[model samples]
Target: MIEFSEVSIAYQGTPVLREVSLHIGEGELALAVGRTGSGKSTLLGAVNGLVPHFTGGRLVGRVTVAGRDTRTHRPRELAATVGVVGQDPVAGFVTDSVEEELAYGMEQLGVTAAAMRKRVEETMDLLGIAELRDRPLRALSGGQQQRVAIGAVLAAGPRVLVLDEPTSALDPGAAEEVLAAVTRLVHDLGITVLIAEHRLERVLQYADRVLTVHDGRVSAAEPAQAMRSAPIAPPVVALGRLAGWDPLPLSVRDARRRAPELRAELPGAPVPAPIEPGAETLTCRDVVVRYGGTVAVREVSLSVAAGETVALMGRNGSGKSSLLWALQGSGPRHSGAVTIRGTDPAGRKPVPRRMLAALVPQSPADLLYLQTVGEELATDRAGEILDELAPGIDPDSHPRDLSEGQRLALALAVQLAAEPAVLLLDEPTRGLDYPGKHRLTALVRAFPGAVLIATHDVEFAAETCDRAVVLADGEVVADGPTADVVTSSPLFAPQVAKILGGGWLTVGQVAGALR
Candidate 1:
């Protein structure tokens, strides 16, 4: 029930979307796919009249949602017909508790108190957030916050829903839960859903239609037809293309049915050589971090050797983020000892923090404070550094104006310019497409130091890391080579491993074996 007719949008004489024409029928789940800074968000904003109205841009042509023209109606006026959930859930929160946040949208729409209460509970049960009714919004984990955000929008009872990178910060299981709930909404309630996501593997299975945005142009087609030539696709689709499978499979179950012949073609494929870690660069002993009565991290001891890349993977709220912060020496540690190059990071030494380690948190905007990319680069003398890390970013664009992937690249460039001995990144591929993720993999491989990354991206870990350290309930449960850890665990295995039933972790490896 969303329509865009001859829509061309520009900001300060720069074109973002050009003459885009498309229609999304009611009850259809449409997926938007593209690279970073490719106008996905801009198109989503135009649905609720936020592009030219709140964002201060120039809009030409028309955008209508549920037969209401967005050009004539403001976002508030169209609130009853459309609901939007952005990338950052914390930024959109206006209340303190989960129950309150869910009810806030209904109250804003001037619904009766009884109706608001009923919808809040129904939405909570629908999204499986009933246990977190009284929890504070700020204290919840990223995945829990995401559930609350979606529940809030669904409680509004709108005809259409627009979500931007809805599951970027969630673990595999949690992502499945969120997508299942959205699918139920489209099928059970006939509510149209439009999602812009980079992790196509997780959401493509549930989408009825696909929309591809590339080089400022938008095209729509059936999911199978669109994925055949789409610029970005999941690993299973890539594998199907490489093996010449007809009617490419979108899920692991379908791929496995057709994988036997391909598996027999390449009998004994060789695994890539693993990286050998050098001398110890970082060490921690009995690290414990607590928040009031809750122990986020228990007595955990870990070490990272020089020239090693270790991926710290676990479910949501599994203490991965807490452990990373504790090791950084900037966050709270109730009782622990962390040493960097044989020196305590929290000691009275004169060395700067940047020299020891640099952390890129989940929210990259927290580390960016400058107005524009040009000024931030000038402050750190990182013009050449950013170019080497992630090129083709506009210097005059505001840091907030950049897309999620571009913002992440800028934050990484700013941190890598310091040349730290150790690097820590949390959910680095949150909004990055395949190309952006490839560039990040290359950059991480080229870094000359020990690196520890806390992430839920299984594909990325398989492609870049040499080792995997998995934590559960604030304790280390599994730690070994990447292949051994990922292949042995069902929850953390990549698509290729699930389909081929071997140790194949990526499509590139299968292609190598066939060649």
Candidate 2:
């Protein structure tokens, strides 16, 4: 249903994709895998003519979707044949309620009122979102919002559906909900699906084919074959490689079945030297946050010591973000006492509060606005910090022009330069690859102050954080050492822990003992 013939695309005189010839059959779920900023989005954009038509790039070859050449057809012209969903579902929303948002797409295509109503209901039912029809779009959970976004496009009855980073912001259970819906579309409806995701563990099992894009080249293979040498891989694949298993396993269950001999080789998951947390640097008491009638955060009390890192984790709507915002002192807090070294940051001025605690938000654009990376890091020895975190970034390049991973690094540099007593990061691994994540882990470990990370990435948390705190219904549910909290729960455990069934939470830990 989709074909690319010797397609070469360039933006600003730099080649993004070169000589890419591929075909995706109807009803096939094809996954595109690559490191950060490796032209994965460019390939997806070319499907419906977003690459050259809207991005103003040079296209040297032809891309045809459902036998319609993208050269002559713009996105609007091809809307009937193709539906595209972006990384942020909230950014693409045009209506306030779920039902209205679903119908808006059909209205633009001039679909009849009767057919629009029929398809809207059908799409919601198919996505298992029938109960959310009246919910406001902003109030929905991350997974629910993603489903509404998918249902909105599916109502148009397009032959091809494309998703970019569909579950980057969702927790484990929520990510499963979104992927389950996508797999149904391919199996029950025979819709051609093309998805680009950094979290391969969530989508690899559902994919029929995998397209590995690296350095402007695209190679097609089955999931098992593609993961053998893919540049970026999930923790399961890394464990398989470390053990020298023939034919890498894609899922935790498969890996566990093949891991008996390897298990015998290791003593119980090795225990590392305990880190001594310093005196308390951050403390919160009876924190309460509300959004009108809904209570987002309950009376939560927590404390973080100097030279310590804590992971704040929960479901998509379980008040993880709300708690982080309240502690930052800039967001809403109906009642709370947040102190850093005996100083109430909430009572200080904006500049003073920033000095007391620095927050690196989930979205990179929220932190970077200056024209160049050099100007943004022109204070507090941030250039030295960036050199240690991610070296060789062009100082003069536009902050917005950098790749997702590089932009995150630039933002981290800006925050680390402040030398605050407390540091908070929300979803820091959204666009980072394995190497980028390791770099971040190293930086977090070496910092002298306290750190709290609000994230959904279990593996990254295991690698970086010494403690884990879980929230449910806007209240703390689980709090303990990272290994104990993650390994004790199936939903929150990392791949290695799931496979080995012990204190192991990352491939690095297993590799260190086994190798």
Candidate 3:
């Protein structure tokens, strides 16, 4: 259904992908993997003619989708044949309400009104977003927006589906549902799906074939062979490699079957050393954030002392973001008292408030307005901090040209430049790799100020956070140590925790403790 023949893509004379020739059969689900800025997105964008066409790049060869050449047919011309859902769902939204967004694609294709309405309802039901039909697009959580984005394309009945980090923003359960829906489309409906994702642990098991984009070349192989030498890998695969297993395990269930013999080497459930937080503090009491009739955040009260890293854990729309924004003093706060070091940020100017408490929202792009990486990190110590957070990024590269992880690192560096008293990060791990995440943990761990991270990446929470807080329906449900909170919930538990089963939250913890 999709074919790339001698394809070489370059931007401004700099090659991104070189001589890539591959064919994906009808109904096959092919997963594309690579390091940040290694041409994974560029390759995926080429599937529907977004690379050289809309992106203003040079293409040397042909990209055919459903027998139509992408070199001649642009993204708009191939929209009905190839549906592309990018990393940022909100950026692609053209309609206000969820129902309209679902039907807008079909309307453009001139589908009959009766068929459009039926497809819209079917898609809403398929993705479990029926209740959000009338809700405005802007009000939906990042995960909700992602689902709507997929539904919008699915409603159009496209033959080929291209998803760029489809579940980056989704909660675990929601991710499973969405993936299940996609797999069903591939199996039951015979629709081809191509997914480019950094979070391989979520989709590897579901993929039939794996395509690794490395050093300007695309290597296609089975999941096992592809992961053998892949630069980035999930914790389970890392653990399998660490243990010298014959065939690497991709899923938790598979890892657990082989974990018993390995568990004997490590004799203890890790007891993390308690951190000594500083005296400076950030406290939010009775924080309530409401959007029209929706009470996004209830009367939630939380506190973070200086030198502390707290993970705000919850499902999508669980008020994790609402609480972060409220504490930042920019997002809506109907009634709340947020103070950092005895100073209320609500009364301060935007610039002054940033100095008090800086927030990197879910969409880190919102914090980035600069043209290049160098300009974004022009402030004192900003470039140094970025090197610490994520190294090897080119300062001359445009912010748009950077991968999701690279852009996120840039956005983080921009916020850290202010030297705020309290740092607020919402979904900070959306596009970070395992090594990059390690660097991020080191950076957050060494930061002198208090930090609150609103995230769904439990593995990251295990590594970086000193404490964890869970929110449900905009109210605090549980607050405790990272190991305790993450291990107690199966959905939130990391792969290592599921495999080793003795509070083993990470491969580092297990490897360090082993005989």
Candidate 4:
């Protein structure tokens, strides 16, 4: 009941989506998958008329949703027919309390006060956020705020739901909750859902059909089966097909149907044998960090032995990033101490010396500021890009002009210039596509140093890390083998485990067993 006909949109005089025509049937769940900057967000905006109307784009063709012409309707009017939950929910927040946040949307539609209250309560219950009704929007965690945003839109009872990377900012556990809730709304309540996500494996099973968008055009639209066989299938999908499973598994349960053989052949899985222990390298002892009124991290201690790779896992706002910052001497630490090679991080003379630590932030470009990529590398150390450990990225071009993968490579090359003994990566795979992630992971594995990574990509952690640390509410909750924590623990278990079965933590492991 939602359609786009010969649609073309340009932002700030630049074309983002061109001649894209598609339709979403009533109650059908469809997934729009593409690489970064592929116009997936632009496609979702057209359904709600946020395109040429609100976003200041030049619209070429007609768009309609739920029998309403998008060109003729404003975002407020379209909200009654379509619900939207964006990637950063906090950016859309206007109210303080959860209850008011839900009511605000309906209130804008001029819904009767009594009906608004009833709808708000119903939505909170449906999304399992009833207990958070009184919590202030600022006080809620990233996941809680996102759920509240969904509930706010659902309260309006739209016929169609359009979400743009709704789970991109959420942790694994919170992401699962949001996805499950979306599926329930579609299967049991008959709501049409269209979602654009980079994590294809997580939402592949829920899709009635999969559409691939590339370079601002609809590249492929087919049944899930056809999409699975396409040359550009997600890593897990390709691995499932290679394993000879009949009709290849989409979700974990389907993969588990063959778990008997899968488990029996565990010996054949090509997991790297445990390496010999190395000497102590980077260590954090009783670290405590507070942010004004709240203690974000407290007395959290961890260590990364020489040649060891450790992963930090947790829900968003669980103090994972805070702990990383404290270790890197970027965030404020209230009490306790951190020792890297017997050198405290809080000291003023900790730069590129006895305890050198390089932190690769969530956005690699955040640390990049040179005119040319070669100059960016030169800024840190001459000929640094030629290091055998660095990825092959063009050196002559501007850093901002490179692709996400290339930019990530350049960031690493610069960080390695100092030849730091310790590396700290925070969300290294945030915006990467399937291939980009694999390439970056390879680079991480090849680096010669102790590494500590904090990420939501649990599969990556399982593939790269030997030890895992799970943090929640400013405290270390669990720490042990990466496989044990990711596959068995409640906090670190990823969607891959929930979808593909327990033992297959990484795509390589899953593919190896299948072969």
Candidate 2 weakest ten by summed lDDT: 385-394
211 Cα displacement, candidate 1 (Å): 0.8
TM-score of candidate 1 versus the correct structure, residues matched by position: 0.97
Q: Tell me the alpha-carbon RMSD of every candidate.
A: 1.6, 1.5, 1.9, 4.3
In candidate 1 the C-alpha lDDT for residue 1 amounts to 92
Candidate 1 per-residue lDDT over residues 107-171, each given as its tens digit: 88899999998998899888889999999998887778888998888898999999999999988
Error of 4 at 329 (Å): 1.0
TM-scores of all candidate predictions against the true structure: 0.97, 0.97, 0.95, 0.83
Give per-residue CA lDDT, model 3, range 1-515, as digits (tens). Answer: 99999999988898889999999999999999887768888998899988888898899989899899998898989999999998878989999999999999999999999999899988888778999999999988767788889899989999999999988888887788778888988998899999998888899999889999888999898898888899888888999999998699988888889998998887867879778999858998999999899898989998899999999989988989889888888888999788888988886899899999999887777777888889889886889888887787889988877888888888888889899999999898887777788888988988899999998888889889989999999999999888889989999998898888888888888878864
Off by over 4 Å in 4: 10-18, 54-58, 74-77, 219-223, 230-236, 261-271, 274-279, 292-294, 347-355, 360-421, 490-504, 510-515
| Shift of residue 486 alpha carbon in model 3, Å | 1.0
Collision count for each candidate, in order = 0, 0, 0, 2
Quote the lDDT for 342 in model 1: 85
- Pitting candidate 1 against candidate 4, the one with the higher TM-score is 1
Off by over 4 Å in 3: 114-118, 121-144
**lDDT for 13 (candidate 3):** 90
- Candidate 4 residue-pair clash tally: 2
> How much is the lDDT of residue 509 in candidate 4?
67
lDDT of 2 by residue, 22-85 (tens): 9999999999999777888899999999988988879998999999999999999999889999
Question: Candidate 2, which segments miss by more than 4 Å at Cα?
Answer: 387-392
